[model samples]
Target: MGVPATVSSTSSTLPWNVHRLPRADGSVFLVTGGNAGIGYFVAEQLSATGATVVLGSRNPAKAENATASIRARIAGARVRTVRLDLADLSSLQSVVESLEVECLDAVVHNAGVALDDPPRSETPDGYELMFGTNHLGHFALTWWLMPLLSAAPAARVVTVGSFAAKSERLDLDDLQSRKGYQPKRTYGRSKLAQMHFGIELDRRLRAVGSTVASVVVHPGGALDSLTPSRPPIHVPTTGARLSAAPAALLVQGKHAGAWPAVRAVLDPAVLGGQLWGPRVFGLRGEPRREPVWNHLADTSVAARLWDASCDLTGVDPGAIPG
Candidate 1:
């Protein structure tokens, strides 16, 4: 498909630069997996705009290093670290209980195992590794933070989705992938579940008259080569550099790739239930609020997934007061 000036009736081509984002001095954002990849860039950009960032990672040292890097790049940048392993519910609960603040401005659900070889096994929670970490982990985290989120006047929950969502179908019977599992398919299914949750979350929040905005976005195909060669944070191997050489033109850097999620979190005009992504090939281009794909719009499927998620994670969506 040719890159058009606009994507659909609801969206227009949005040429954006991270520098154009408004100052976010007093706001606080919790970014999962903020130590690297799109999550790291998102943290850097958010902190650059003066937001207080709580960088969450499974590794305290990595999270600390990421915080140090952010502080180094953006002098006086307010940042902290939180230990969170999404695959573990105990870790999620412990982190939430440790939060000192009653409200959070935004929670960027950006952490997940993407593009790795298929997990040989399931998570501690007994679900497929990809699904558990990508969808279920964020699901539980959001539910646990619902009170803090709802307390904020108008908080936003930005779930990081992927192009993989465009091509995968969910197996309601085997959401855990007990029957079958392929790396790419599993990744796509997890992301699709996330998009479904984001959309349904918006609907439920509105039904309960909550002010939280639930938005989903995908960082277009982001290549490590397109990203800067930041030592410690991202030291590409010779093979990686070689692989990225010919593919550079096809993918954008992590900075440009981070645009959609950042916009989803900060763009005041972005409404709940909206889905955003790159305009060109859904891979690379400016962020645009495009139509939700047909499969992703199936309320029945979303409702089922929501119920399953609540059961699997022991988080009741209805528990959040209307």
Candidate 2:
């Protein structure tokens, strides 16, 4: 059952609120870009609920600090940090190899980037940074770690997609934006690809009889993320000053934005193929309810985008662990 635009965000029968999100006791969870922004809060809130969290960040120092802060805030919480740069595949491989396969109950594909960077930039492996990091790197990492997720009962894989994804037109010839990169377009396309991958992933999971559910969420509002072509960096949060109203009342806080995603991962009742985000039109309010984005249902384009992502990432969706 796909969500239609006619379904208003406020129509949620449960009147969902973030404070009441369900728990994840005795489970191990993984989150990428968990050092700051929405990912930080996602880890914090999950840890608050007694889940063992393995947060990933690009910088070792930053990862350590973020983990320490989480421990400080939630005494006795099981939280650790691993160095993971989505732009770097070697790090993804090393991290996957080190982890105990089949222990993760959930994996949050939360890392992302933005900003108008130089026309062309490449990953250490010479692939385009934006697509490589935002989609393919995460793609490889998740599949490699699938065995771990499948071992857990009712595990989930959540991709932090973007609303801008609805607007991107897949340009297969210039996926990396090699010839002339339009910063926003490149970033937008990567996001779109992520969303498509999420949708296709859901279908693939069912086919394999995997207990894991693949879900997608758009946090809403800009949180200092850059496209892959940009840098892996965290900017100080802007919510304390803005959390009062319009930002709170109008714009969604990155932390607040993460609530829906967090809920989707932990709440067993969440239906598969769900897309979470803000309710008050676009990205301006209510983080708990189903954010109505009617545009995500363009299955044709989504299927094409999914096919392209598979080609680029080199992972056969069918071969993923059950």
Candidate 3:
């Protein structure tokens, strides 16, 4: 499904309220992996702003159900779905070509894969599953979608990072995690790579004097148990909510988890290269501009990661003329 493209009147001069998004009438945004979890909520919230929301999902049925849920809650909401499989590198261009919009106001890079425990797996391109999908996939997608993004007056690319990435470091030599793979650690590193990419992308975009902004955000400790019901998608039982009540004091539900990304997308004052996360102890609270972690601030590492990503994906995000 598709909605007609329109000029965006999104302005940074407007006041911002996290609970209530700025009106984005005539804008179009894409939320990868928007079928469920935090992505779903991002789509729902964006839909309320009157922006045409495109949900990128690998499953058609789930995508339709998500769009239906959004329509059910927000009257006259405009939403569409596109088949997107980040793991399959060859198919990405086709996905971008399929989009009917002439310009894209923003894209929330929220789709990711996490492996708790496992015999390590690789994507279709033979890269580690976590690193491949979480980092490289979005990296390539951005490259292909840059044209549409540039068409907008001030486009934003919001990358959803992870709290797990805070303590992790990238091993440039073994980015694929081929040497020794601990599922938890590997997942964290992948997200770390994503953060590095977002920051590096901002640097490149600024160096080229492009209006497109890249912002990174991480949800604190979001648990599904604390999430509100969105029937046919996520419906935590009363018992589950009760069991999670104690933890709610420290953490939050996925719905709240979507806050940082939402703010990054619509907060006009938000500049490129800024990091946004929960305000309270970096765990749970209203979204606030936060400092980049020391590990994530290493420009050398970020540059190397950018080069490695380009080599692996065969796409140079910085290829745009300065």
Candidate 4:
């Protein structure tokens, strides 16, 4: 069944509070951008629950340090490091090949690019960098790793979306912003694509009778000022600090923002096709199964976006059943 169109309750407490989350001792999870930000907190909390976590970072040194920090905080925490750059397909392929695990319990597609006004950039593949890295990269990674996730008794693919998606509509005709590009618009579109992909992927998995589940969640306005300082990972720049100073009053801590995604990963009741996020004003409060944007429900758009992602990345979703 699809998520209810409206929620009846007004509970302030989270359904997937860290203290109440189930232990995951034997499972393995791979988290992209796990080295810092909300991703870092997600990795830490997962490891705290006894799950074996593989932290994905574009920089080997950063991954190593992040792993070390986790181990330091949680004695006997099982953590490993893998170099992953979402903007580069070759890097993703290499990481997929190097994996030795028999089953991947969950994958947190958390890495993405976000900025206010920035020069337009492109990925190594010559696609718009924001859309390419935030959406297509994750699309390809999930496609390549689906087999491993399927091997597990019950596995999940958690795609981290953004509150920014609500502010902008997707322009399917100009996904790359070829005509003209605005940084925030492109970023919002990228997140919208990710959310759309998650919903569509859920439909596909169900169609094939696949056990693997796909869920989308967002950290509500998680800002640098609200997020804890972690060197090299959560470092604040002058511009970032200036922007965050005002936002600090409105934004939730990165850790609090991460709860929705973490809950999406571990909550057994979570069904595919549900969009999860904070319950209070969709920004900060508690994790809940929120309704997705109306446009995201348009299956036609989902199918086209999925096809476009596959075409751009050259990672065929058809290769996986459903």
Candidate 5:
């Protein structure tokens, strides 16, 4: 996507620019893995639009750097940094402890690891690495931040999913990939789990009369998560730029790729349970609300995925802080 119609002269100076009509004046957001890639762009764009941003990363220094860069571009952009390692519950707890009094308007679950090598690995929490970091840790983080989220007049929780999700359905029997673990299956399964959590979270929040909206989204690849955890090859070495490119070309900046998700977070017309992604073949272009994805968005599967997530994360959805 090119610069927004309302872009400033300096907007062209940036590597990535987005147009979010900044009514986000008083909102607070906590974004996971925000130091780099899609997460960074999400935080920067939201902050430029007047939201206070709490950038979460495994490295607080990197988080600070990303935030500082945003401030340099958009003077006084309210942003801060906190250390969080999704794979480690201890690190997750530390972030919660650090934010003892901060409020949250949204939690952009963008932190994910994509390792497509031959072997299967487990997190410190003992789940498959892909599932553990991509889904479980985020599940734990969302539950950990429920109170801050519920306080807002209307808050949202955006789960960043992927097109690879089309291939993998929720695997309750092998949620941790105990029986078998293919990297693609592992990543897709994690994203599928996230989709369920988003829908289920919306249902549960409404059941309790809460004002929060949980929205699921498939950003549709083209973005290479630029962190130490995810290496270069995972970005799809050769291809057309713009995830919106043909299904064949899988090249796009993490920043340009974060559009659909930002829309899900800030678009007031968007329904609470609405799902969205890219309209183009490869999922890079103006965002459009999407219909429910089969199997992954299946209510039965979503319910099961929700329960399994709670079981693995040790977080009781019924007991989430509010």
Candidate 6:
């Protein structure tokens, strides 16, 4: 399918520069799975804005290490770790309670699970692992965080979707993939659900006259081999870097993959419900606001997914205070 036209284009005369970001002093932001990969880079870049970045991870040790790495790179960086296990829907309320901030400026739903092979697994909640951790997990988290998010002047909920979602569509009847469980196809469905959630959330927020913005972004094609070294967290060997150098012309590293999420959080012009992705063929280059995929633009499908999400997760995001 051909790419859709952007909802609105960023000015060509003065394009957004990812290297320099607007200062977000005193704001508080949360990044799920911030211990490594794209989440770690998102946390690191957000910390540069002087915002107190909370790295939400299931493992305490990994969270601490991620925070340490961020502190080492940025002086006086106010960063902390939170114990978050998105797979466990029951524990999420307590996780949100653990956050000390009175108001949350933004949250990046960057964490996810992608099982390569199967023997398909299920979360403690009994849902398929990928859908459970990626979509339902963030759905429940957002439901609980509505109050804090509403307190901010203009809060943003950034859902990091994937290009993998482009061709997939949710089977609302079998959201768990109970019938035929293909790892790759299931992973794409999970992300498609997430993208639907982001857009549906914006529609609901607008209906209620809420100021909270729901933005969706996809990191176009990121590879670990092309990623920058972050000490003990991630250190690509010389051989790995050299081998991946040629591919750099096409795909980018995890650090560069984080640009869309970061830009969605800080850019004043970015509106809720718009999709963002890489500038060059949705693969690599600077971040730019992009048009929603044809399959992803269906409101009826998104609405059905939203209703299913609320039912599965047992939280009505529509009930959140405007």
Estimate, for each residue in 57-81, the C-alpha lDDT of model 6 and write its tens digit: 9999888889999999999999998
Tell me, by lDDT, which candidate is best. Answer: 6
lDDT of 3 at 56: 96
Runs in model 6 lying further than 4 Å from the true structure: 1-14
Worst 10 residues of 6 by lDDT: 1-10
Poorly placed runs, candidate 3 (over 4 Å) = 1-15
lDDT of 3 at 132: 96
Clashes of each: 0, 9, 0, 0, 1, 0
Could you tell me which 10 consecutive residues in candidate 4 have the lowest summed lDDT? 3-12
lDDT of 1 by residue, 39-106 (tens): 99889888877778888899888887788888889999988888889989767877776667777888
Models 1 onward score TM values of 0.91, 0.84, 0.95, 0.89, 0.84, 0.95
Q: Which order, best to worst by lDDT? A: 6, 3, 1, 4, 5, 2
TM-score of 4: 0.89
Return the lDDT, model 1, position 108.
94
- Pairs that collide, model 5: 244-284
lDDT of 5 by residue, 181-238 (tens): 6787888878777777778788887777776778887666554532112221123334
Residue-wise C-alpha lDDT for candidate 4, range 1-322, written one tens digit per residue: 2221111122123455655566677788899998888888889888887788998889788788788888988999999988889989867877776667988888999988876776788898898998989998999998888888888877888999988887777788999988788898888999999999988998888888877888999888776676766665666676767776777556687878878877777777687888998877888767888887787898998888888887888886435762
Q: What is the lDDT of residue 115 in candidate 5?
A: 82
Using alpha carbons, what is the TM-score of model 2? 0.84
Model 3 Cα lDDT, one tens digit per residue, 1-322: 0111332335445555666677788888999999999999999999998889999999999999999999999999999999999998888898777788988989999999999988999998999999999999999999989988888878888999988999899999999999878999999999999999999999899888877889999989889999989989998999998989999899998888988998888776677899999988778878999998998889999999999999999998767732
Q: Which parts of model 4 are misplaced by more than 4 Å?
A: 1-15, 229-249
Our model 1 lands, by Cα RMSD against the true structure, at 5.4
Q: What is the C-alpha RMSD of each candidate to the true structure, in Å?
A: 5.4, 6.3, 3.3, 4.9, 6.5, 4.7
